[model samples]
Target chain A: MSDPMAFLLWVKGPMFNWALAIFALGTLARLLEIFLLGRRPNYAEPRGGEWGPGLRTVLTRSVADPGTFQRAPFDVLVGWIWHVGFLIALLLFIPHIELIQALIGLGWPGLPNPVVDAATAVTLVALVATLIHRLRHPVKRHLSTAEDYLIWTVTFLPLITGYLAYHRLIGPYPLALGLHILAAEIFLIVLPFTKLTHIFTAFIARWYNGAIFGRKGVQS
Target chain B: MSEPSIERGLQALRAEIDAPVAAFFSSCVHCGLCAQACPFYLETGDPKYTPVLKLEPLRRVWEREFTLWGRIKAGLGLSPKVTDALLAEWEELLYDSCTMCGRCSLVCPVGNDLQYMIRKAREGMVASGHAPEGLIGAAVRAVQTGSPMGLQWKTLEVQIRHVESSTGLTVPVDVPDVEYLVLLSSMEIINFPEYLEAIARIFDHAGVGWTLSTDCFEATNAGVQIGSKDIAATLVQRIVDAAVKLRVKNVISPECGHAYTAVRWEGPNLIGRPYPFHVYHIIEVLDALRAAGRLRTEGKETDRLSLHDPCNLARKSGVIQEQRNLMDLVAENFVDLEEHGRYQWCCGAGGGVSSNERADALRRAAFKRKKAQIEAVEPERMVTMCATCRTQLEEGLEEFNMDIPVVGLTEMLAEHLVEK
Candidate 1:
């Protein structure tokens, strides 16, 4: 419905280019980290049967136990909501769709408007709630380093900008969309550097854990 | 209930430890990723009992004393009150609930050592006379006497004689000029006598010159478990003194996990010098034997066997890989459970939590994750390297009504070893 050429120009302009450059540089830095630090494997060896069983247990226990949910209910609730919301927002954003469309020619149907809108709203609310929780909780506050706040800011900014762009509440739609894309690129670049790197490493950590316990005959 | 002298001693220790304990709490990021790795969290799903939440009391202290905001909060008397009830809750949270499994640290992106933090917190609790009565009493006895269980030298001599008769191997105690001095926990001599037989069989089988000490025989350092570094050092010092007297080249730690940490990591530091004799965990010794082709294992017929990595051996001490190497030699139907190495779950026994009756239900509940791992393999028996893990799993599995039998790797090795 918007002017396609105008949107492209804004996305390709100096502001977007600078953001893309920084984003690319940040991503490169993250990749370099793996090489620089070298791979430190978690000590446990892989148990052959562990992956399937461990996954089943993790899934079942995660749902069955309300105690874990109750212990830090607000924290867990916000954490899951933010994480799922952020992921959906990343995947279903129009620019991501365009990229996917360019690569695979739009074979799949796009996410429904209501789902995207809901995820976006939830992401914004969850992020703010998490930030507030971090500030107010004594343990969290004591533990919150400068880098932690920086990570939160970097993560939250793009989500906020993308929401604003989607709502056409910030300047023009094209400008907002371009800003959102730029913010996203920045996020991707920083993903590996910040605590966000846990995204890539969590499963690896989990699998490593499973394998070790499997070898030792302990439960993962 | 109040022993003023004990109370005074605790107050002094608490005063000494307050600052370092406070600093450790200030270091966590509170990401809650540690939840997924903790078996206790998996079992009860209690957030307050999660490894991170156990650190909250210390976190509050950190905020009050160290941080600007915390100081401001404290200045205004707006800080969360650390009531006697809160301290009591923490005693349950820190000791009863946590196994100090080190899984939380493995999953921690920041490399925050939650086990160490928990151990220190326990130590602080011990200092404040808030530790579980059983753990503190054991530590106190170990300090007063040599052994945590207070088995006299004569009882230790009788146990050694049983080992001598059963294995037909002479386990010379208090012998001078032994090249290697093997230190064992009282548990091996009392309950798990097979562990002694296994060690004696291995040492004799390897033709390695090693002897057990009559004076300082026990290796299970309850001080390490209860967070009494002084008592831990005192217990270890007896072994070190024996080693020095016997002129042993190596101090082979028995199959106890915490014993290895007490004697290996803290021993050198406590003694204020690197040990002249290198310390070797029994698994390491066995691995060396297998590696050198000095020992061979006859593969046993079994439906399936899983390995339970003890938290101290796997995570705290970095001896995870060696155990796997030994397992390969012993089990034909060995099926690995998930999260084996540094990431492995605890046996719900470490950090003296195994001795705490109040934590028993929580400990049993925490075994759900481990039980799920066992059920995955559909194994008949689960083997582990730690004696405590073996006991914990045996008790834990039974409490959960799992049919799996838990045994030590050494016991399994003794069963399957082919005489060279």
Candidate 2:
């Protein structure tokens, strides 16, 4: 734990194991609770089919509606920008894609360094703006739980630290790289325990909602 | 009834914690977007009225009773407690402010069925004796006198006689094996007698055989508004029994939105069996008749008019297109309120809000959204299918000093019917 090189090895080895285990198990348990909490079967005769609307909503609900966008334009724009940016930064970065490919056997052509760097920058700005937004808005501030802030900080740290390390802005490469991995490990451990679980649950929720509405003959 | 208490309320809430509740709680991003979609929040600028926050009691119940961390936090006094005071405070938010219009559900980014949870949350509120007095009175009258308005069979008989005289057609009562068994809301029975006359004329013109039941003609369900499925099931059972005994092929719900929901969507679920007869909103039946060439009308209205899609009819059930299709048939210059169909703004009178006096001010305030939509179009008259929406539109427009009249679509269509 004393030498910077040893810390980097620990962060990449045992620390990674612990974070990945918690991340995988915690998310699975939460997802299982939702999908398996059974109920009485619906007895009413359905007016229309469920399958079409069920999948339709899961795909369509990714964007906010116009009424929603009008009231919270900043939120809608920044939120989408950050999510899309995160995916790009995660999937299109050569290093991250190599890591994922080595583990999962899935590989795609990585975006250019400059393009990925730009996306990472936007994502970082959006994350900070969203934090400021939650602090400023009365309703959003009230709804913010401790977990919300914790998850936001943990998620922001890794991305910001990675960008800083890549450009050698925060510290020497090894020191900054160790901290980046450390922050990411924390994010992985906390992801499933917090609202970040919404990534897996959002579609399950939308499908359930849409199917019920569709069964009742309404397009949700 | 036993004096309502928090223990009973907690037990009732525990029963509603099924798969959907867990999933919705899991998926809420807490972005506060639903607050913008809510009329209670939009009109009053109150965060507590956000559809998701109104379920705080239910959410607390889910956390404390279900989740491991929630259980640990709750044991150590980390999570907020669900108390009698909380239920009392949420009663207004759950009942008075919410129309159960399902608009918030439509707008949720994660697609949380906020309206569905609000309906379940009312079970806790009612068990805690936190329901509005107006809704409670409606429930009692509905159970004891067979109509929430306390209109008796004799009253409808009088309307029946008046309709028979006006239309020169007998208003069939309790006739077995008719193609449709028409049901009326107590509001329609006591207030809009012309609805019965209009139906008589339209049915006679189309030669569509239909009958009313003396045993159970009331379609308004006070149980639904009060959020007691036990009472709702009891009322719905009466309609099922009547429909089954009469052997009617279809049950045509009157122009009452929740009545359509209670009898059509929630009825079989309440009764724990599939209905032998199909249920249709009056507009759906009218649309079918029009499609089949049974509904023949000669003339079209010449003024600019628009339609108000009742929340239950359009959003809750998929009857949106039927009303618009019917409107196209009869109105020469029909214009749509910018947000018509499933995205339509509520008249703020559905979900039992109109029955509760405590909600009157909030109802009018919420109606401003619809009122503005009307002004945007500036129609000469506003037409709607549900009688509750019709009544609320009339009252809401009057309150705002806007003179555009509200007419029931069925009556307007009857006026233009091809003469028998």
The residue-by-residue lDDT of candidate 1 on B326-347, one tens digit each, is 8777767888876567556677
DockQ of each: 0.06, 0.73
Error at B289, model 1, angstroms: 1.6
Per-candidate local distance difference test: 0.68, 0.88
CAPRI quality band, candidate 2: medium
lDDT digits (tens) for residues B137-158 of candidate 2? 9999999999998889998998
Displacement of the residue B145 alpha carbon in candidate 1, Å: 3.2
Task: Please report how far candidate 1 places residue B158 from its true position, in Å.
Answer: 1.9
Q: Least accurate stretch of 10 residues (summed lDDT) in model 1 chain A?
A: A38-47
